[model samples]
Target: MIKERLISLDVFRGVTILFMIIVNNPGSWSFIYPPLKHADWNGCTPADLVFPFFIFIMGTAIPFAMPAKTFDNAAFNKIIVRSLRIFCLGLFLNFFSKIELFSLEGIPLLFGRLAITFGVSYALMGNFSLKVKTYLALSIFGILLFLAFSGIEEYREVRIPGVLQRIGIVYFFVSLLYLKTTQKTQLLTASVLLLVYWGIMALVPVPGIGTANFEINTNLAAWLDNELLPGHLWVYTKTWDPEGILSTIPAIASGISGLLIGQLLNRSLPQLEIIKKMVIGGLTITVLGIVWSTIFPINKSLWTSSYVLYTSGLAILCLTVLYYVIDVANYKRWSTLFLIWGVNPMIVFFFSGIIPKVLRMIEFKNPEITAKTINLQDYFYSSCIAPFFNNPMSASLVFAILNVILWSFILWLFYKNKLIFKV
Candidate 1:
């Protein structure tokens, strides 16, 4: 198979992951720039674009990663394992949260118990059967369940869905579709799925909530989240999940869009033709999304159909620009910074999340503050960084930039060592 692997893919992925880290690790959520914040309920923001863009990029990589059109038992196992690993990583991230961390008096618990249980179980079950290993895994997760809803009311239930989880799921289904179907089939599937999602969300009346609506918690997606899995919901709003079930239907379409584009490049047409087609195609989808948004609305939280189209169109345009400049025009020096992150995105993403949570876990009593306590990360930000700026937003942004710099240094070291690992 002829594969058209462009360096711009890495640069684009790197750029997305960079913004993801910045937007997610703000020193204070209150001090975030408006562009960094997600849309309150409807509309898209710069922050909102990161996830779908990442998903889109992942779809583009699918053809390059797995060129074979055939699927076997081995393929099934590989997809399942990778998807689960990414999903579990997301769960690990969710398990370590600030609001849910504190148990009684600013003491973080839960994850430690789960980790120890897994370690001890694995150590003892060295010669166990597959069935026995399954049992052992269940026991470890059982501990997590017990700990999640065990104590204080302030500590919310553990979240089941997240950015990475959604990514994993999208990867799994999109990969399957890519292997099983032709380009025409994949495109048709994406279009049909989007239309079906639009219909379900618009026409069908939400049960228990009465009329069909897009209200925060009363929407059909929110109802399914609350009904299907009650306690295992996002902490932000217990009633609805941003990466909820129904929204994933449209989310799949976003990934398929990338899959189609990836195949488009595989044809290896002339450079001008590729650029011309991409611009026209991107604009067409974008205009459709805008027109559709008049009725259905382009909601980031809901992961609306229009959202899938809008984001996917922009992603195509963004990749086209990068492809032309970096690949066609031979501009390479400027994108070296992005390549560091692009080379080790999975590790960077995992550790970037882990570092913040680990820092939050290590708390020290504030010498000056009387009534409350602060985590190590927050304390450092407040005392060292926040002191310099009058605007809290600037201070928070600096802290975020520091996170980027710290990770960049780490990624640079990993790149220097060539220690890249994939799940």
Candidate 2:
């Protein structure tokens, strides 16, 4: 008999993806309430929990997705190729989102000098030598350097550290960690990583800055992110990029914890028993997370140890619930929406990123604000959609619901055609 796929995992992944899309695509960012509001600097919010929950789900699915037995060279090569493809796709998305290709005004002097130099050396250099490769490379590098030194200019904000990039890196490293390390070793390694990260953030004094506190000026995390990354690359704030190198360590731990759960679930246990264990485990972890938060502060920007535990615990609890509902109870109807979302997460995420830009390109005049125009997305949400609803929260929900329906339809089409695009 053909074995059945894990209904719980699919449902869990689907639910997580749905929340991710909803939380990300709010009706109006400016009008969001406290729950939706990202943790200001060093506190946990519902919004802060969403990304880690998704990452945790990714970890939970790993054991089921990856082969049980050891792999040969060919299998290893396939894994590497897949990982690289995912990573590169994320980078491509990043590149496309930013607009630093070329500026006619910024390079007038360089263009003039280049034209003169090329004119003088036309015969010696020929058409082949006159290729734009050198200019293009120099231009790209120059733009990056200029951006780095410019100190977070509004128009040049690239938001370098992003969800996709982090997901790519975390997925790649965590998978390797799983392959290389023993279960005990992986758990130990995760523990050491969390403690070490905490120590470094707490103790390390940044140059011209104090310890890594929540304060923007004094925090070492901000200092390191700003000093290390190009200034213009910061998405949320120019002073500190959220996806800094240091913060990623804890993020990986979140995934590792998920891997542990995956390992647990992979064992030949009864469905109801597993659900019970998961709920108990999740609750235990969550309690510990809350307790730890007293000391570590549960900061999402920092990706604090407490935050990781808390989010992971919540993720487990969520999985447990879904497992009970979908797998044990055999309730599959509601899950169809989430299944669609889980199946096409990367595509949906990429489209969400690009679609807003496309909408912004098609702007409508704002009669209330002189010389200011609102994008189609904003107009749709604020003018037409939001006004239909009585409250801001309701309107936001409506907007997110609409996106879910739209994306769900798209994914259903993909599913109908048996189109599963990995990586």
Best by lDDT: 1
| Candidate 1 lDDT for residue 365 | 66
Best by TM-score: 1
TM-score of each: 0.88, 0.82
lDDT of each: 0.81, 0.70
lDDT of 2 by residue, 298-406 (tens): 8887788888989999989888878778777888887776786676676666557656655665666786696998777887887779878778887887887788788
Per-residue lDDT tens digits for candidate 1, residues 336-399, read 8898888778777666877776677667667787667678898999899999999999999999
RMSD of 1: 4.3
Candidate 2 whole-model C-alpha lDDT, 0 to 1: 0.70
Worst 10 residues of 2 by lDDT: 121-130
User: Model 2 residue 172 lDDT?
Assistant: 71
